[model samples]
Target: MGEPNKIKLGISIGDINGIGCEVALKTFLDNRMLDFCTPIFYASNKTISEQKKRLGLEISFQGIPSAEKAHPGKINVCNVWKENPRIQFGEATEEGGKFAIKSLRAAVNALKKNEIDVLVTAPINKNNIQAEDFKFPGHTDFLAKELGGDSLMFMVSDDLRVGLLTDHVAVKNVANEITTKRVKDKVFTMMNSLKVDFGIRKPKIALLGINPHSGDNGTIGEEDEKIMKPAIASMFDDGHQVYGPYSADSFFGSGNHKNFDAVIAAYHDQGLIPFKTLAFGKGVNFTAGLSKVRTSPDHGTAYEIAGKGMADASSFTEAVFLALKVFKNREEYAELSKNPLKKHQLKKKTKAQ
Candidate 1:
């Protein structure tokens, strides 16, 4: 009743066979989480009960017919799936894949209708989930397809933030996808996300070089100079503080990444390898350039550690916190834009104006 902050959150249960349900339950067990926001889970009640039992936690779940009934201190399960094909830990099945997809679809619909403030998704298995009915390389792509196009995937943490230009693609095809248009769009998204999602007034960005030692100035490869450099120059011309085409090998070592607010990598491994190596269980996977705020943990569904209770809930918790922060930042940015202020002004006015 304290001012009715009324923050409603939508959580998509990832693969039931994985630890998604376990972490989702554990993360909500903290009454402090309810104090910040009301979590509305898109999963079956049976699955939630099973997961709680599996984790040996006596968490209580309440079924809410709609978001309006959600309250603090109690999780509201929407129950997306009717049939509970209880899956064994660490094992993958078509039913589990379908159930996960159903939850995702329900969450997306709620997002599209503006029923939820933000979405915090758990990790899912890509191979098992990709079928004729459900076809997406990952959650980001699926969310993009559902919400529209032109979304960027950025890993977020307090110290280091990295954005991937191309995600969930084979290494051989990554080079072909790194076109000038893609780079420009991704950079624009990254800068906007930092400003609007993370509340950075003037976001500083570092672009990672695709080759070793930044192509050694055409000695190794010309993609960095030919494709990446021009994109950075164009962004500079527009008056954004973006730098680099730095070698992936030495960028982190130089500590230059710490200087910038975010780093843009050329491909999946080029960005994630450094981010995960540094972030480990701390980073949150934030999908930028979307109409709605969405975040997930940086790591995947660890089938190996699935029922062992070894899966750390820290990253998943961070994902929830970051998603809420992004949602709040977006609201703040919108308010500021409607009544433009002089505290911070860009040389080139935003299209939002």
Candidate 2:
């Protein structure tokens, strides 16, 4: 079982055929990582042993029957399966998808039951992992259903946060997906997350335009004027520090993103392109506005360098640090929320005559 004080962190091993296991082992190889939390990997003992040998990593972990037997001050592997998995390094196979789901399901179940305080997921291939039981687009959608709440695809690197209006939707369907309700919900989710997760008092948000020059007054497109503008305006009138239908082309390049607490992009690539370019090898994909704390590395499964020992573990390591930091922040925030401080209006001093 987990120690009374050490936070139990459940790790979901994603895509056995890729670099998930490699990066995970690299992250935990440093003994300093165990000081923050008790790490529990939802994979079998044989699998971990194989990965260690393949990668030539010098580390040892205890094999536990389940998360209930996880111990602090030691790396724990919850052997979800008794048999050894067929690990084809650098290849995507159906077996890879199946066992990935096994690890994910076990970790998620532990997260749901409060057996784990936080969850740090490795990357998974979206194509092969599609099954009838898990028909969602990605982790955000699946976690939203299991954890219950509006999950925002929040990419975080220090103070730079970029949120998505629509995630995993086709380019042709992006415009139709941006409804007033969707905008409002996303804005609220982002706003609330800034306060609760990141500890911002009043969040200043920038909204990215859907078209060139923010529609150029309807010359290029009508989305900015017709849909995005009105929604941002309405939210601003509601006393939220929401601004723009700004041209996304110049926003990040001109360093305008650093001016706000967060930026809301119209779609997945719109936010991710700049975010990954700026924060690559260091960014963390954090799911905001969820009931539970879940985070993953910004990068995906590197099939090309799966077992070649060429994968970098910095992003995965950052994900671990972030999950633990957010867990403590949430606990403190919840306590403060119970008896929040009253908002007081300060009187303006009269000018001396």
Best by TM-score: 2
- Per-residue accuracy of model 2 over 59-95 as CA lDDT, tens digit each: 9999998777888889999989987888899898988
Error of 1 at 23 (Å): 1.1
RMSD to truth, every model: 3.4, 3.7
Cα shift from native, residue 109, model 2 (Å): 0.6
How many clashes in candidate 2?
1
TM-score of each: 0.94, 0.95
Q: Rate the local accuracy (lDDT) of all candidates.
A: 0.85, 0.89
Q: How many clashes show up per model?
A: 0, 1
lDDT of 1 by residue, 1-353 (tens): 31246578899988988888877778877877887888899987787877877788877878876666665667889877678777788888877788888888898898898888889998898988888877789999999988885899999888999999899999999888899999999998988888888777788898998888889899998898899999899889899898988888888877889899999999999888888998988999999999888999888878888877777899999998998888888887787787656324542354346
What TM-score number comes out for model 1?
0.94
